[model samples]
Target: MPHLVILYTPNLEAQADMGRLCRSLADTMLAQRDDGGAQVFPTGGTRVLAFAAAHYAVADDSDDHAFVYLNLRMAAGRADAVKKRIGDALTACAKVHFEPLLAQRHVGITLQIDEAPGQVYDGKIGNLHALFAAAR
Candidate 1:
């Protein structure tokens, strides 16, 4: 399972097209491949969620400053190189998406990938996977 969550400052809401960014990021995730050339993430298991923080404080607590934090959570069994590639792809996508905003305003964008050795209690129930499989 790979769920990419994007949290950004509210000030950039008007300037940023988050929906487009989400789709771009999801597409980036779908494009990732392992060294063996197999897909790194399952099609149906990919999810991207974005939220505009209603309350937050950035460096110096200035309203002019904005931040976008992207966290990618996935299962733990990938080579370091694979993970780095995934992170690089996603970061590059975000950077391009926010290029216009970056030029006009002060913004910070960060991407992090998280994976635990074994989740304590992970439960998922959905038919999305079957839908993707059927398409294949």
Candidate 2:
């Protein structure tokens, strides 16, 4: 089944603040789970992951870009809302960790959501090897 990769630009901090933002995003998603079995990426090197917010840094005179990259797994049809929910969670998270930085500019509040389809796979070793060879 295909999953999703969501990337956004939101306000973030310089040092430890990035780590704090990643955790907050995870916490927000986990709070909404009803056994959804979703995973947030890069948070401890899992499939579902979160990178340091500063990893998204883009150069702009406006200082309006702060990037947050997230990857999560879900069944085929769950992409749309999951993307929006991530945005919402990010907005909330930014308010706490990055608000003081962004409040001065006001222009940094925008979120650009980049959503992409992903894949999920499960296999036994020899069967997987056979599948790969067949594809080639």
Q: List TM-score per model, in order.
A: 0.97, 0.43
lDDT for each residue of candidate 1 in 1-136, tens digit (9 for 90 to 100): 8999999998988999999999999999999999999999999999999999989999995789999999999999999999999999999999899998899999999899999677899888999999999999
RMSD of 2: 9.1
Using TM-score as the measure, the top candidate is 1
For candidate 2, lDDT tens digit of each residue in 1-136? 1222434553443432555555665666544422375543322222223333434556665556554444554333445666676667756765676666655544234444543345455542434335544664
Rate residue 50 of model 2 by lDDT.
38
The per-model lDDT (C-alpha) reads: 0.95, 0.48
Residue 43 error, candidate 2, Å:
11
Which parts of model 2 have CA positions greater than 4 angstroms off? 1-16, 34-75, 79-83, 105-136
**Candidate 1, overall lDDT?**
0.95
